[model samples]
Target: MPKLTFAADLQWRRRFARAAEGLALRFALEDARDLRDEPDGADDPDHVPLPVHRDDYDFDACTDMFFQDTDVLMLYNARFDGIEDPGGETNQQIGMGDLCTAAWFDPFGNVKTRDPHRGFRR
Candidate 1:
């Protein structure tokens, strides 16, 4: 498991948290977007604890904070364009282009990145 990073959009966090909670997994969440957007003492009255706010921290901090015991699931786009269904070759249609989804990552560096602060590129 290599240390890989996946950037998940903020909207999906709640649903993910609920699902993980139900599955008896202790998941942690940091708002990366927030971290990116807000830098140098930018605090909202209703500031949520997100990655944007905590840019100083790295990947390990996120993993330790959220994915301590459970697997880390990051959301990403499933760009399966132009891939036709095998059984339905006659029907020509592109696959679902983009959507909020999750991917499981191992705890070790092999699964995810050891450097939490690194920007995710996908």
Candidate 2:
């Protein structure tokens, strides 16, 4: 596994500091196993499909739905055993709810606002 160099760490810190302005920070843990095994709400009546562009939809649409109002900073624990394959592919999975929940709760206590003219208020 590779480690973040001092310069890289400093650069990330500077970028994070800048982005943190008027925003809250949150930390959540989701094991790759759990994500991989999560049910797709096939039998759940309350399940609502994520929004996507009507014409062309794909993984990017799912990502857009997930990070609608919030920015994501992913930190992978590649040093952990059994998480990566020889091809360097990871078993991690990210879904729309994760981003929505992060934005819903201002974990760092930053105020949230939404445009009144818009239908939804966050």
Candidate 3:
């Protein structure tokens, strides 16, 4: 895996620094040995899905627990593969939520904001 640098700009950097001070990040790696095992939320009893790997580890729990500190801000970065649209070949979106983690803001931070779906206060 490549090194993913995490930082913020002048304004948000101060906010992030103030919020993340003295916080400890707990990292856990999920282990999977079987490649043909039943999935966790399989609705169909007859269908066995491919086994999950370390990459499938869900961070919701960690986020929920840590995000309770309402005074702090949690930033997460997500990347997806394949981009095919009349707009271009890349689709990058940033999501910012309130204390409830309900996306109060989600915009294309990396791309031009000429799109109709682009806005800062959605």
Candidate 4:
């Protein structure tokens, strides 16, 4: 796993900030382990702590702080967009096109064939 530098983190924050326009949602670059476990326990046996300049001990509690009573929550698995599995024989990985295809539907299962590149060209 590659560690994110401070510069990279700031860059990503800016990108997300731009993308989150009119969404009224707060963005955070949270660690995977912090989201998975409490402070006192080991989240996973294979977990290896990555070095980050800052630590947010209350990240889990603060994640939903911006949500209101009327807000509808929709979480997308962005990791699926570019994760490669080394254990697979073919070294399977998901592409941006695949993610776009998978998410080209409304909550009611209505297909929307809009090109993803029109908005975000990742």
- Compared with the true structure, all predictions reach lDDT values of 0.37, 0.35, 0.33, 0.35
**Where does candidate 3 clash, by residue pair?**
none
TM-score, candidate 2, is 0.22
Model 2 lDDT on a 0 to 1 scale: 0.35
Give per-residue CA lDDT, model 1, range 1-122, as digits (tens): 11122345554444444334423422223354345366643475454464564455464565556443321122121333212232333223323222224333223444544453443333
Alpha-carbon runs more than 4 Å astray in model 2: 1-7, 21-87, 91-122
Per-residue accuracy of model 2 over 39-92 as CA lDDT, tens digit each = 853333453454434533243443445444432332234353333222333423
Q: Identify the superior model by lDDT, candidate 1 or candidate 2.
A: 1
Query: TM-scores of all models?
Result: 0.23, 0.22, 0.22, 0.20
**Model 3 misplacement above 4 A:** 1-8, 21-23, 27-64, 67-78, 81-122
TM-score of 3: 0.22
lDDT of 3 at 2: 10
Least lDDT summed over 10 consecutive residues: which range in candidate 4?
95-104
Whose lDDT is greatest here? 1
Report the lDDT of model 3 for residue 105: 22
Instruction: Rank candidates by lDDT, best first.
Output: 1, 4, 2, 3
RMSD of each candidate relative to the true structure = 14.7, 14.2, 15.6, 14.3
- Using TM-score, give the best candidate's number: 1
